[model samples]
Target: MNDFWQQCSTLLEQELPSQQYQTWIKPLSLLEFDIEASTLHIAAPNRFKLDWVKSQFSSRIADLARDFCCKPMVVHFVLDPKVARRANGATMAGSVDSASVQLAAAADLTAQITSLNSTTSETSIGQQKNSAAAGSGWSGSPLTNHESSGAPERSKLNPVLTFENFVTGKANQLARAAAIQVADNPAVSYNPLFLYGGVGLGKTHLIHAIGNQLRQQKVGARIRYIHAEQYVSDVVKAYQRKAFDEFKRYYHSLDLLLIDDIQFFSGKSRTQEEFFYAFEALVANKAQVIITSDTYPKEISGIDDRLISRFDSGLTVAVEPPELEMRVAILLRKAHSEGVDLSEDVAFFVAKHLRSNVRELEGALRKILAYAKFHGREITIELTKEALKDLLTVQNRQISVDNIQKTVADRYGIKIADMYSKKRPADIARARQIAMYLAKELTQKSLPEIGELFGGRDHTTVLHAVRKIADVRSKDALLNRELHVLEQTLKG
Candidate 1:
């Protein structure tokens, strides 16, 4: 049975992402197999995990089990709480001093929490001192994987995403400070620090910095950061295979859980249901949970209200788009890291026009650097402009409301005149709203400008149209696909 499970792990490792395989499939244990009844019982950590595995990877598990057993076998996923408890005990028993220190820290954290609740006057000063004390004695292992019950436990912190490398600006300073506080104090302060922003913001980098800092402070701390989509996929597999218990155990055991793009959880009820449990368990155990999304909690429609409340209960921070000076600093800092010589003027030139997010700024800088290297040219404002001419053209293209209306109308098989017409039919209204949304997103048009263009409607109406389309795009997968196609077509 053990051999067959190992084989299954190998096969799954080939199929799933490395992190996904390690997180969901590796912890499974083959406990028993009844040949007569054709029943193969697999042990998971908890009910949540059992359900996750059953839904997610059951078919693959059954196929492989049949191949191993030489017949059709019924697979059963049972919760085995003792398995994880034993594994955790064994891992923590590597040294007596380590265990003692951890216990003392846990005790101290409990006391801090109590004091924080009971007293409000000196709480601020007390918390500051406690936070400093918590961060003072930080001597432990870097983030490394450990062999837990033959399944490796690991964290997904990108080594490059340290606080030292993160460029602090007015845009992300608060987020960076909050992340630092979370890293230093862990669950003691901001148990769940939620960060949200547009794409290309520093959310991913900041979260990685926190994990890296925490891992550095405490050796062998169980930290797991995963994408929300990956979490949903894991839930689906577990549900199919009936292994919710194992899923629960692994996730709930973490010292810190960082989930990125949490907005992806919209419309995935089962995943939300399972994650809510895992979240409760981790929080109850004083484990830190950090999440990132592209939008604010309230703005994220289609998600359960309970889950949004959980997200809101945390210290929610936004990483806004960087200003001109910050963008220039980012570009120059990134160039310095790569050992590339970039002048202030060139950096400024690149930053002035890119004016989106940090990621786009970095991307443009990289392209310019690459272009200079490939052509053996010196870096200058002119050279930068030449290198990024095509991109700049796209960025500088005044994508007017007229252009968007025409494009969306043509794509949706509607007449362009309808955009300017007071047509309130369902299909025409839908197309008009899509055009307004696209204009808001793809052009530099304001709500008033868009409203004026679309049948002289009010600015509030245009805002409503934009919000409605954005909400529908998130919930309607087919409409989302069509929007993607439309956006790509327009861009091309």
Candidate 2:
């Protein structure tokens, strides 16, 4: 098996550019092979890489494995650091050769992997071979072997945020589950997981968790975790430095590419153009790309329609604001992490009052904690109320149905009277429905009150319009953007 892998390595060396092979393929170790079952177990250094390989080159690997091993080989790439460590033994002190350093790094990474999974094996023949490899100074660069020979620095990922740490609830369970399945095997179920929600709603967390899990599984994968903002920045930087080739090289070489805050890319035309090419490159390679944003991809204003069309070509999940129970759980978790104790009642009180945003909710808890600690007093409902008095006052400000109707009407180029008219014309009816939807969504108005204001329509009519608008907003980018704009106008 060792000789086979070395032979395969040599084949890959000839097939791929030096940088790519070094960066992605060099760290991989063949863990087990079942010729009868046509199964080959391979270990990757991280989940990012596993996702990359599975998305970008699993077929290629399978084809190569069959040709090399003279059988139909099913490559199972796992990101098991322990396997790598077991395959590559400890590094000797005072080793300066590049090969020795890689072996040492692989060994150290493997040890960390084993520590992460204690029930795994330690002593193995592969470890001995890795030790020998370390001593022989055979460390070759993995970057040169990539399909895209121009890749720049690899992306940095946060190790602490994995699938385990992400708390799932009614609001995020589906998104969490989808992310897990995607991480476990990219492009199998949901090729592109589109996670959308308001800010700080755990979209980034879910995608990062996927990356972490894949890495933990030890798949020799090429994973790229980036923010759309960073992508834009990189494109701009590349333009300024005349390094567009470098930019293309960095982005097009991923098996799994996770992008966050995609809304930031909506307005930049040149950036969007570059991203479109990058997107095509990854998708063409069958790589999985997960994106998260405060709004749906279609709703992202100022983006090219073609780019938006590509974004809609997969499953879309929305991470809603945590329900009351989930919010309380979040508060408790935050308190625990901060080493502060809070009674259940206090936690619920904070959760209920600060339902607007997750960041705001956490900020409120921190403020209460800080004030209580400063005053040498225990946390109580009364103290919590006092601490959040200003926020509560702001939340208590009433938004009227009439105000929402006027706001929607003004924004949509419709007469305010049209909202109360029995107009069956497409534009008028749509405008009236939007007014009703906005009233139901933005104001503290009952369905009956909203209907009464909209030409004596029934509460059910208002409810139906709200539901229809919500549904349409999910798939209709223009409608969603208009609705968002109307909501912002109303809030302002």
Candidate 3:
């Protein structure tokens, strides 16, 4: 079974990208393989993993099994705790089990955080008593009374998220500055700092950095960093357990709350109402809240208008995809953190090609390092090109007509639907024409295909838009400047 799994892994390592293989395939445990029945039973640690494998890799696994066994083979992916425990037991007896290890780490972290909370609660209690005697007002910390109430102190914060490690550029300088301000003066400046951007643009990293900063500044500061989906799940569980008061107390007692991907809260009415009350109580007591999403607050649908308005009340900033130079800086910084001496030329080569997002850039870098380490060769431009050939091809092909339209729409402050709309207003018309022109320039799609993308207009209309933009560019200074900037942005 181990031999068969190893062979399958080798085949997958060649077929899929390095990161994809490491993320999805390598963690699979081969629990049972029957040669006579030509059946293979794979064990996934949880139902989520089982479902993901079945949806994504079932057919591929079937094919690989047949190839290896020289017969038709069926693959079954099951979530079995016994299988998981057996696998862990096989990992060097006398060593700590994985579950035990995770629990131990969690326990240690909870103890450290509880100590901080205890001290802060003591301080706040002292302050409250002193203010009571003086007949003066007191803005009590939310964590003060909660510690005695026995609420859990759990933080899903990553240690690596720190201000010192975050790379800032023109694209994200404003957002970074705002994050720093909120971290330095929580609840005082930017009460609900709203950060939104495309995926992998460091929104999560920035929020975690703020949480880590707050924890370091004040030992007793109660902080919780949760994804919106997790929060929604907690809401459902609270309803199930009939512990709404406990849920309200736990959430409302935080000094700093960071919610990532708030877009997930859309259409969840009950969760929204509960969160509305929690949001109100937290803000009434001056607790800081920060949220991240893939879209602006006003643009998020299905959420209550009042909640959206509250999101917009604070400073909203977009973290754009990093510029080319900034990407290279990020790659170099990441390499340094890993103790890899990546050169400027090679980093530039990798960064120049992987223009999608920071995640792809890092994935490419990891592949390159693996290639270099495996082959015992120096890191160079030639090596990067070889390791990233397939990725580069995909990236090049991904600059589609749809992508160009969205990029142009986002740049011009116009709706994406404007491209297909019949409204002839000057701004919308010009932006639509520019999008058509960019489609003609950037993508390899035919005129009619581009026309179809833009509300079934004729090829001649696309040609006219392209030619009109070309002619106007030579004379209109402002239009030319806008076109130049737009082209640069799209190219990046």
Q: Model 3, range 113-188, lDDT digits (tens) per residue?
A: 4355345555654554443323311133335443333333455689898877777654566677778767766765
- Runs of candidate 1 with Cα error greater than 4 angstroms are 1-155, 398-492
lDDT of 1 by residue, 1-492 (tens): 667777888998897533345435766788897778999888865443465577656767888888988999899898775745542212212222222332333334434544554354346545654554344323232333233332223446898898877766545666776787678667666868999777888999999999888877778677887988888877876677676666666777677889999989999888898889988987876678999987767778789999989887878876766644466667766776788766544665676577668888988988998999999988876788899999999887746677788888888799998998988899999999999888876665557767888878887688678769866764564676567566656655
Query: Quick one: how many clashes does candidate 3 have?
Result: 0
Cα misplacement distance, residue 368 of candidate 3 (Å): 0.7
Q: lDDT per model, in order? A: 0.72, 0.68, 0.73
Off by over 4 Å in 3: 1-153, 400-492
State the TM-score for model 1.
Answer: 0.55
Clashing pairs in 3: none
For 178-270, candidate 2 gives per-residue lDDT tens digits of 676566546545657899878777888888888877665544566778888778777777777777777786677566789999888867999
Q: What TM-score would candidate 2 get against the native?
A: 0.57
State the weakest 10-residue window (summed lDDT) of model 3.
87-96
> In model 1, what is the error at residue 385, expressed in angstroms?
1.3
